[model samples]
Target: MEPGAHISARDNVVKHDRTDFEVPLMEKDFAELLPRGKMPLANRLPVLNLFNQAVSLGGLKAAGAKLRQDVIGCNETKIVVVDHGTGLPRSCIAF
Candidate 1:
């Protein structure tokens, strides 16, 4: 997608919903820099760590549910307690 395009989790794994940031280079700038060796310089733009929050939450919830189910299915009686105060919500941990 284009640099300023609106993106969502359903569109792809990368979430680009945020529009409050700026791109250091434009298409014209890139075209001009192609002749030089610095066209795709790594330092030209800031590094961003983007993730899909919805996909992450869904995976976590599924894992938690599977863990709870497996623990309950054990033949030996064991007390399984999950703490919900680390960072995730209580509902997520309770799954």
Candidate 2:
């Protein structure tokens, strides 16, 4: 992750403005966003790596954890909301 973008995310959280995450929390900011210099071949939410999440964070509770505003707590986890549900094509990706 970029130092600037990463810290900017934390700063936004500190200020408690929680709605600007259209893509930063999902698509482009996770990668080199288009405006960062290179044009994207396609704009899409990056797929969730289930294997990675499984290894790193194991099972999630039946209910998702809350969306916390703690910038420091961000290092541990950032559960935005309970997931949409199972079997939907796009539901698996969280950011």
lDDT of 1 by residue, 1-95 (tens): 33222333233455554444556565454565464635565445334323433344456667666777764543225443423223212222222
Compose the digit string of candidate 2's lDDT tens values, residues 1-95: 22233334433454333454444445445345455666544433243343444322222321133323322233333323322332112212234
lDDT of the structure predicted as candidate 1: 0.43
Report the C-alpha displacement of residue 31, candidate 1, in angstroms.
40
Task: Give candidate 1's error at residue 32 in angstroms.
Answer: 37
- Give residue 64's error in model 1 in angstroms: 0.4
Clashes of each: 0, 0
**How many residue-pair clashes does candidate 1 contain?**
0
Residue 91's lDDT in candidate 2: 19
Assess candidate 2 and give its TM-score to the true structure: 0.13
